[model samples]
Target: MPKLIVVAGLLLALTACGKESTPTPPPASQTTQAGSGPVDVNVPVEMRPVLSVDPPAQTPAPAAPDVLTGKDGSTYRVGPSIGDFGRFENVGVEQVDGRWVLNIELPDDTAAIFATWTAENVGKQLAIVVDGELVSAPEIASAITGGALQIAGSFTQKEIRELERAITGK
Candidate 1:
């Protein structure tokens, strides 16, 4: 089980670490039919270990080709490559304490599996990916046994609804 809810410094990661900084898909990729894409509720994939880069110049030329720099001169770590990926039984956009969140409910069997995985990987991050882009990566501090997960972020109604469609495929 994952730490049921991890709201700690997640926004900081978004603002400082990159990725979830923008709670919406790139304007270019925005669409009216988001149901076509799939959302992978990874612990950002399993809240796996990640290093946000503040690049150094004159680095070794032998660096991995995939290690590319962002427009802001920051490096984007290829995340989202390592955690668990699955479809939730339900996904909804709602307001909790004045903040909008993505509420996800997993299937019964998956809830048990997630509990085990989260227990083993405490302190790691859980990444949520939609269309292969890292949307949210919140750290897991405890195990999550229930199928319900609430991912908190700065979301507009449109972004949250779009995410809902993407995850539900409806």
Candidate 2:
């Protein structure tokens, strides 16, 4: 009797597996109402909802000071360039806006540097020197232009005069 009962259970399970799965459609009431004329079923499908992402706000970067080196190889701090100039080139110095500017031209695209004034370049300060002493290590604000640029900072009358003379070899 136990064997017969097991066989019956197996048969029932087999029969259930043989049956095909049929999806249940939504109720007729859920569908759109039938129209009197030939209803165009070719209506355009609605567009899917797009994800809206808000970009972070833009903030101005801090300005980087100019770097100067003195005759003794001592570094000094200076200010940013006041006017627009071209790319930097060669080792030379010039005066702009009454300040001494060192022109250290880098062989790279410096457009991004000119775009902002920030303090990010503080650590990688350029070494500016006059004669042989180090003047300052001002962070490069942008690339040099025409192999010349101006340095800005609080300078005493003697310091300015000395720097001008050292830079110009006058």
Candidate 3:
């Protein structure tokens, strides 16, 4: 009947409208798998000392100084590359409490050096330098005698991998 034909047409139209469109492919740059290979990032990191006031250094200070500005119009400095990451033995990323953490392990001798440095610098902050940029300046609670340290940040999996690759260079 004509009524049956109209109902069929309506059903057909509804079904057509319910269909989902094909998804567009992601950009080529974003399709890369994390930790698959070297990621081209300019943010190379280095450990630097933190200072409340700029040191009495000569003009054109170190090629790069990690400067952190606080919301209260305060400025802090971290530099001289005290414990460069180049001496690290291994770096890995892990998830803890649904958050990403970067674990850095150093050799025995390097560990001792860090322990001594941290012990002496207790109650101070160590600037996490990344490509002349200060990412974070965490205070030293206790001496890091274990030679292994963990950096906890609310980073994504991709970011964690990128940081691991950046620091390890592997």
Candidate lDDT values, in order: 0.47, 0.27, 0.49
Error of 3 at 44 (Å): 8.0
Per-residue lDDT for 1-170 in model 2, tens only? 00000011011100110111221221112222221221111221111111111222253222323333323332334343322222233333334334333333322333233223222331133333333233333333233332222332334446545543443334
Alpha-carbon RMSD of each model: 9.5, 37.2, 21.0
Report the C-alpha lDDT of model 3 over 1-170, residue by residue, as the tens digit.
00000011011100110111222221112222222222233444576767754434434334434555432233556557775554555565656556565566676766777778777885566665665554455666556676766554446788667656655555
Q: Work out the TM-score per prediction.
A: 0.52, 0.27, 0.55
Give the C-alpha miss distance for residue 104 in model 3, angstroms: 0.9
3-92: candidate 1 lDDT, tens digit per residue: 123332222123213333223221111222222223454432233334444564555323452343433444445443443546556565
- lDDT at residue 3 of model 2 (Cα atoms): 7
Error at 11, model 2, angstroms: 90
Count backbone clashes in candidate 1.
Answer: 17
Better of 2 and 3 by TM-score: 3
> Largest TM-score belongs to which candidate?
3
Instruction: Name the candidate, 1 or 2, with the larger lDDT value.
Output: 1
